[model samples]
Target: MKTSPRLESALKKLYTAFHSNKLNPECNKHCAVGNILDNTDIWKHLSDHHGSIKLNYIGTVHQRIGRKFNGYSPLELLEIEATFLKACGYQLPLHYKNTKPKNPTDKIILFKGLSDVIRILCEMDGIDNVMDYTKLFEVKNQKAFYDIV
Candidate 1:
């Protein structure tokens, strides 16, 4: 399946970050959106706080003018961050008192966040989710379509 160059590039960066133990849900510079934006915290300025979808003045201006950062609009970047944080069990509009994972660096937790971010990225590009595995459980003639082993 063909994918946007931007999506391809973002996925590559995410994969590297996930495997290198650099992906962190709590850190702006190491989260899913951070990795896609080349591990930069500049995207944080798009919102008033972390894990928020509400765009600030600058973010609103950029979105109004259709400005894209590394191929995603300001709003889209915010959505990606929010999605990732949510998947990692973080409360919205992250705060010191908000609920968050105990082990933010756990590989299993990070993988879940990455999976959700990838799904959103694919959705943004109008493509099927590559991480979806439910197809393997499809039934045909009352039998499983694919072997689990």
Candidate 2:
């Protein structure tokens, strides 16, 4: 798949941070993209498994045959997000870890989350994907960017 300029730019930034020794190697495992692809059990089946069962409060009104379509859905949007990274031949951003490092001198620190990469690429492709996981959104350098969010 052809990647947009924004995806390329995000990839460059990721490599820059990685090369600068600012990101941890395990960051990919915890990325939003990774969380979906690694954690979610997904597979294509010709027919439903008889052993599998689910309780839907409502019938499969959305599905033509009481089954999900093989395409993008609101809840499964993240399912295909991994493809975006693959298309760009890149991975997600290094997010700030939830816990602090034991040693103060540790150089392996995380940055922002995967949404940063997705947003830039999506915006460039005219796919409006907005998300921010920052604890506190701040504008320290207004002159540096055309938009803060």
TM-score for each predicted model, relative to the true structure? 0.91, 0.23
Clashes per model (N, Cα, C within 3 A): 0, 0
Per-residue lDDT for 17-66 in model 2, tens only? 54555433233332332233332334212213211122232322333354
TM-score of 1: 0.91
lDDT of model 2, residue 139 = 47
List model 1 lDDT by residue over 30-106, tens digit each.
Answer: 99889999999999998999998999999999999999999999999999999999999999889989999999999
Task: Assess candidate 2 and give its TM-score to the true structure.
Answer: 0.23
Score residue 36 of candidate 1 by CA lDDT: 93
CA lDDT scores, all candidates in order? 0.92, 0.36
